[model samples]
Target chain A: MQSARADAAARLADMGLPGRRDEYWRWTNPAPFMAEAVPEAGAFRADTPIFADMPKVRLVFTDGVFDAAASDDPRLAGVEIARLADAPQWAGAFYGSLEASGQAPVRRPFAALNTARASDGVMLRVTGRAARPVHISYRQSSDTSEAILHHCVKLEEGAELTLLETGTAAARANLVLEVDVGAGARFHHIRPQGRSHGHRVYSAIFARISAGALFKSFTLSMNGRLTRNEAMIEIVGDNALAHIAGAALGDGADGDFHHDDTVFITHGAEGGESRQVFKKVLRHGATGIFQGKILVQPGAQKTDGYQISQALMLDDLCQFLAKPELEIYADDVKCSHGSTTGAIDETALFYLRSRGVPREEAVSLLVLSFLADAIAEIDDEAIAAEILARLQDWLARHRG
Target chain B: MLEIKNLHVKLQEEEKVILKGVNLHVGAGQVHAIMGPNGSGKSTLSYVLSGREGYEVTAGSATLLGQDLLALDPEERAAAGLFLAFQYPVEIPGVGNMVFLRTALNAQRKARNEPEVSAGEFLKLVREKAKTLKIDAEMLKRPVNVGFSGGEKKRNEILQMAVLEPRMCVLDETDSGLDVDAMKLVADGVNALRDAGRSFLVITHYQRLLDHIAPDVVHIMADGRIIRTGGPDLALEVEKNGYADLLAGVL
Candidate 1:
């Protein structure tokens, strides 16, 4: 007899890949995406350790299983971090829905695969409130070759957590993170997807914000061969707010990056607001794509949702495709989406150059200014400064 | 301090010349006012002298402090102690006035190999200058020339010149958009920065501003060249009888 997970995986295999004809995957074609075969079993390493400076609570997962002895973070009190085998009830409720809906209608074949093989991922629950949020770092290096999927965080009522996740790998890796924010809870998730020359990563973050909860997400994508990040967020509660911001810089041949953000402001959720801003700069024949949709259901009045996507192409060979869509079913709601693609301002460039600033420095300053609004949204000034420095470094190396 | 020997220039890509064989000389301890009717190339002369770029110097030579002025870039000319107070200043968004002023000042200083001034010291220096100019403290924190009134923008140009402290300053009708009170404030700020080692070329369409700054020499320009030269009284004569008599006398 086949297990439920096995049955779902077989069903996904029968469906095959999702193609361009699929409505959701219309802009970004994930059917032809290259995927590594799933291994039968894998184990975590106890000797090799990472994230030494953080609050000491680091969970290392190899393939899809947790390493108990290697994971030691005492501050994880008032919260539970367990595997599917340990918490079958919680897993049944969460994974059961995902398993039942695995083959529903998602356009991406990878997302179906994720749901089918959704074992070994962590389920973090902060009941009532927690002392400090756990910091989960997904470190996928060359040693662990199997596809990595292990971090899933959820904050219950009145809970608060700050998650810093990094996708550090030299080989092909697929990471999926699912976060559920309960009523009045706050979640700050930061993902810095570092890139390798020959690596390809597809990461999907599925989050649902309950009533009065806040979700703030920041993503920085750099040095990826072909990286696609998707965030499907649902505002299931009334008066909820979500702010999502991301910045990406692509360089190198065949360096393709794609981002698809689908937000659903459900009906009866009055005073719900969603704001998303994504900025990208393509260089050296690199390609970037952004498809954002804000769906306001019926009775979702007073829902203010705004999205803007801007790109700066350094070379004529560079390409960018930006599609911003707004579907409003409710009246008396303010929703707008705008997209623009152009090169740097030559007049402003000349103005700066006439002031004795070198052409390169002038362009860099302007680019920094262009990305400043996104960077400024970060509450931590130190983190903001670090991101800005990294952005400047990338410009200095690739732009010159 | 500045000399132009038969300088000829044409506005961007134009076949016709604007400043044709215009000669002007200004030494330290001197203020030269060039009054001309419309279409006399007064603004073109300022743009060409400051190396604003896009102008074709068909034939001419301009030297500042014995260095080829036209050969240098705009910032280079500025670092060489040449300043042009524009008739219409540009509004640079997202750049605070103090930040822009400090960056420009530090860039010039760095070019000279001088140590950069501390932020505290720079603020102190700017605050003192702003008080004398009657500029509000809050204005320094706002973006440069963004949403500034006409008089306020003109005052900002003068404030910049004062901070830059160039050896020779060219005022291109800085008095055009200013009221009487604002005009007096602008003139007072320029006069306070005046020194024996610095020269100024004030370009105006009326003798109203001359009554305040009191130019040392006034030259009447017609068509594209200077037709007559005289003391400060020439501005009054032109104001009383208009450029009609002045052009007739020159012809």
Candidate 2:
């Protein structure tokens, strides 16, 4: 475990920190993150925290430190959970493996910095279907706290698990989640992030899927100043599926909102499938960016990959930038990538207004419809409904 | 109880005029048909009445139940008991049919200071109205007009009309793309909503739709103006002789 941390530190030192000149960080400025001291952010106490009523194994993190008294016991059927400081051997072996393997083709410097510095996270080992979801609630209590957290999950063959993460971590947050899906296993992850005032988030997810395994993750982001979310996934086993989707609503009242989604998925085995769907709604000079790629390795025949990123700009002041790429090294593969930046459909708006819906209400409805594709990725009915309600609330609060 | 006196309109993007001195009077419990040639400003009247943007109402006055129709916004017009069944219903993907219907219904009710219906009541009303148009549950569950066939789109329009229950309805060439059976279904849906307090202005190019809905009066329009006004016999004459004769007669 120590050696793995050392190697991650060395990797971070080699890559150094990303600058504006870096090809991957060209669209998103890295100046705020590169500052010697983390920027100060105000602490926000959520009035009604997300997933508060859900039945689950709750883990509470206050200002990047675990709060055992505020959390439910970390015990569930068919699962073993431990903090990173007391990680089991199985988790220690696979902790940095996925994150390291994902570094190739594109360098993720923030993820490396997280792996090298993170000391607060949960390690989960699932050998069978978990009784319920594991909900991680990140509650920030200190206004100037900077959090670096890393989580590793190992799912044994034929096992199943669902992970739900919500709320902001600290004034500034750097989170790395590494997942290993075993053969025939299933993993579902849903995260609703960042309602804190002007908080910045840089998060990454690195996952590997084995034969016949299923891995799906979705994110819903709102009310964040600067957010950069990256995901690197690999399908190393035949006939596996990996899906990742996100929906972000950004309203820069004074031109402070910026959100970016960067993703790379690799297909390394025959009959592998992957999908990346992301949608962002920006208004009032907010900026949205998307950089996604699908790579099919040699001998990875019969791979199916799809990627789409779309932005709905409410006003001419808003900005949207996208770069979609697909590199195929094998024959007999099906892959498609599309990126679109457009304004609201005037025809649709007129149709709604003609049907008696007010302009504001109609715009909100259309915005929700635009995000429906990405939100549809969540299979859980209750969770999806919760996300929809939160989105409606946000739209109502930030009316035009 | 709808009146339009010397209504003139032109495109906002260009200087081309569309409707010139259009005069229409639709009384309560009456169904009037406006039969005209292509570009005769048949659809333009419907759009202008519904307050669609990109139209400059140069000189006109339209009143619905003695209220200024031209003064309100599009949504305000809708809430004031006016509905237009589009010739080409816009496809709105990801907005579920049921949800859209409920939202429109509730919005109108709210605007009119009436209590909004509960979800159960809305669902029941929608299902009952949709069944008449032969719109199955699956179609209602899908997005509004998305992936719908031509007939299905027409039927969806009628379903919306039935659900909203407006006082004055305008059908702008609703029979453009429909087979006989589908047309019958749509016509049946429209007829079921007919009441003494509700009136309709059925716009079409042929007498075929009038055969189903059976308008009380038919007006022949040509060159942005109504050329002739008569009973149902006038529509048959134009359908038989074609709009060229009507256009010639107007000239």
Candidate 3:
């Protein structure tokens, strides 16, 4: 298994990188960035974040390897957290089972590469509800290295988990995450990937939710050179619900942000509800792309889904493109999708200004209002307040 | 404290002129009404005075106190102590009424270098004023004018004007879309706001509202021009016998 894993990594290295010619990689090319991708072993450097009040359990990753010494979070009682000397024990079963299902075959080359080279990824098997939320942080401190991987998380029936995953890299990195939600279980995944300076960041999340289960994931991407994020959630059981919200901020001259989200609610499932809201703020001539699709299989009765994606362009040079599609076969289901891309309302601005708020302050107020719905969804009041403060700070730093 | 001299304004998109060489002046301690039929340019006059964008002032000069009101932006004019109660107040969603009023008031104060009113003080004032106007306190907590009835929206407009306390106020067709009771309440609110230091230009199409508010002077407008000016009896005359007599006399 160890030799096979190493050989897979060697094959991944020989495959080099994905270019625009590939179907999924067509919009965002990662080849020019792959030439600069330098693999490295997990190591740590001393650094303190401004907000130390964040929950303490974190899985720290330097480059692509897992840091067993730095990440001493005892709360993470999952399958494995330490480094892998060889392929994981369930690797063959995990890959083979998913492929035989014939549901979303590994379409992207990067996903294939991640599965081949990823030996240090975490395997979190949640049997039941955990004590507290798990905070996972993957940091890349090196300037010339890439953090690449494939992560698999499985949750059994009646299990509940909250996972806070943040990816920060100085160079190039590609992080791939796969999650399986069991029946009557709950999974909350928060992916905040932004801090990739001059790096290419590509992340894909594939999830399946079972009966009487709830799976919700919020993606907040603010900083990246070339970023592409895709989240696919499949609802296969009755009375299952999935909620996904994403907020992305684009920065830098050549920075490109791309998001493709596909949520599927399979048949034989009744009373399934899904809601998604995607928002992007484009700045500095950066481009933001969002593609969201909701598919309801035949006989998926009583399915309720709502989707809205809005983009605010700060300047004329900045661009935003969005496509929200809905495919429903169930006649009794209620589904709606709306997409809008425009500048701020001038009338609202004048109304605020006439009331005497300065232009910048008025803009901030309007922007906050634009994000009011998203902020209101935070389940925890204290955490919601904390997130609002962080958002204000982020806005001040980026918008100002 | 408000003056409009030879205000000849035309609609930018068409051949119609709304206000033609109309001269009007209102000193403090006065309530003047311009009563006319539909298409008589009463609403256009208020909009022009408020400096709403897209109105071409072909030949006119409007001033507030001694400042050139036409030279300032709409917000700056608002800061300069000019206010217009719109015929159809624009609804702004997601902005609370109290927040909007306080922000507008404080903005005017800030422009004059005055300190902002504390939230507690503003809330107390709003509550008292709202009670007197028969406006529910819950209405003030909602988004401005959104989901509000016609009468409620008009009452809200008056509420804002009272809260702002502008030196010169223009109410454009405030009585058009109100029930009898709502009309009385709104007029009472306006009457309470009237003071020796403030002036009002009430624009309306009917004499019913004038009977309640009691404007000191009445002007009859026809074809974008003030064709006749008289005492309050002029409003009664037009109300008793529609615009037929007035149009006949003018023609």
Candidate 4:
């Protein structure tokens, strides 16, 4: 255990902190993260839990530390949970390992920082179909606290699991999640970020899929001061599918809010399908960024890939930046990518208003319609409806 | 029921004037057909009346039941019992047709201090109205006008008019993209909505639609003005001899 911590500390020192010179960090500066000091504990009261209406097994994490007394029993049929502190030897294959492996072709220094600094995390293994979703609710009682969490999930052959995540862990948080789906297994992930404007978050997901496996994830981000979410997915076996989608909204007149989504997907096996859909709604000088890439390796025949990133800017003061790239080495693959940024359609707005819909309600409908494509990516209808409700609430609060 | 006095309109972003001192009136239950050549400001009158953007009503007063139509927002104007069937029905990709209709109906009802219609009641009402317009169940479930045929789009507009049940309706080139059969279907839908408490201003470039709609009066529009007003015979004359003779006589 001591040796592993030493190695992680050494790696952290060697990598240091990312800077503006880094190609990936050019659009998002990491100075705030590097200079932030640990915050003191304070009172925090959340208005409502994101998935309160859904049926699930809940796990609570407070102030970056697991709260066993407040959380439900971590025992369920066909599933095993291990606290990282209890078995340090098992950390080699799950912790920092997957994060390190994802560095190939591109480097993510923040994920490494999480590995070196994370004090506690969850290790989950699914041997059979889970009875219900497993939800992890993060709570923060500090005004300026920081949390670094690492979670690893593994699914056995033919097993299925749904994971739901919500809440803001702290004022500033860094999270790294590694997932491994076995042959014929299916995994679904739905997360709605905390609706607090004081948060600055950096999160990463590293996923690997085997033959005939399916992996789908959708994230909804409503409020934050600054947030950057990075995802790297690799399809390692034939006939596998993976989809990653996100919808974000940022509205403020001060220009202090910014959100970014950077994704890299690789098709390493034949007959693999992958899709990426991201949408952003920015108003009142808010900014949004999207940098996505799809790589089809050599000999990856019959691979299907699609990527689209769009932004609806409510006013001229707001901004949207997108960089979509597709690299296909195979000859017989179908791959496409597109990015667009525009304001609400005046013609559609006028059409709705002429039909007796009020101007404000008409705008809200148009905004939701703009985001409908990305929201439709969620396979679970119940969870999709919950997310839709959250989106509507956010629109109602932030609408002009 | 509807009256216009010296209605002058121009493009908001350009200096080109589209309607110059246009005047017209229609009595209760009367169907007035405005026939003219292309760019004769027939559509402009409808747009200006509906409070569409990009048009500056430099001078005019339009009234429905003696209410000031120009002093209200588009939605407010709609709630005041005015409806405009678009020349080109917009294709909203994500909003369902049923949802749009129900929302519009309830919005108008709510603005008039009436209780909103429940889902069951609204669905039943829409189904009954849609049947008369030949709009099947599938069309009502799909997004508004998305991937719909030209005839289907026109029928959808009439369905909206029927559901809203406005006091004054304007049909702007509704017969432009319809075949003979589709035209008859649309005309039938409009004729079904005619009553003593309602009126219609059917603007078109052809006299064929007036044949099915049976307009009580017809007016010839040229260069943004009403050049001639007569009975339904005027539409026949224009259709038979073309607008060249009338336009030459007006100019």
Tens digits of per-residue lDDT for model 2, A39-98: 777765543567778789999999898889999999999999999999899978988888
What's the i-RMS for candidate 4 in angstroms? 0.8
DockQ winner, 1 or 2 = 2
The residue ranges of model 4 lying beyond 4 angstroms of the native Cα positions read A1-8, A38-48, A87-92
What candidate 1 gets wrong by more than 4 Å, as runs, is A1-11, A19-32, A35-92, A95-106, A118-122, A127-147, A194-199, A251-268, B11-17, B33-40, B84-102, B118-163, B171-185, B201-214, B218-251
- Please give the RMSD to the true structure for each candidate, in Å: 5.4, 1.2, 5.0, 2.1
Clashing pairs in 3: A194-A223
Task: Please identify model 2 stretches exceeding 4 Å from their true place.
Answer: A44-47
Task: Tell me the deviation in Å of residue A275 in model 3.
Answer: 1.9
Q: DockQ of each model against the real complex?
A: 0.27, 0.82, 0.30, 0.77
Pairs that clash in candidate 2: none
Categorize the docking of model 4: medium
Least lDDT summed over 10 consecutive residues: which range in candidate 2 chain B?
Answer: B242-251
Highest DockQ model number? 2
Better by TM-score, candidate 4 or 2: 2
Please tell me which predicted candidate would have the highest lDDT against the true structure: 2
Candidate 2 lDDT at A154 equals 93
**Model 3, residue B127: C-alpha shift (Å):** 4.0
Q: What is the two-chain DockQ of model 1?
A: 0.27
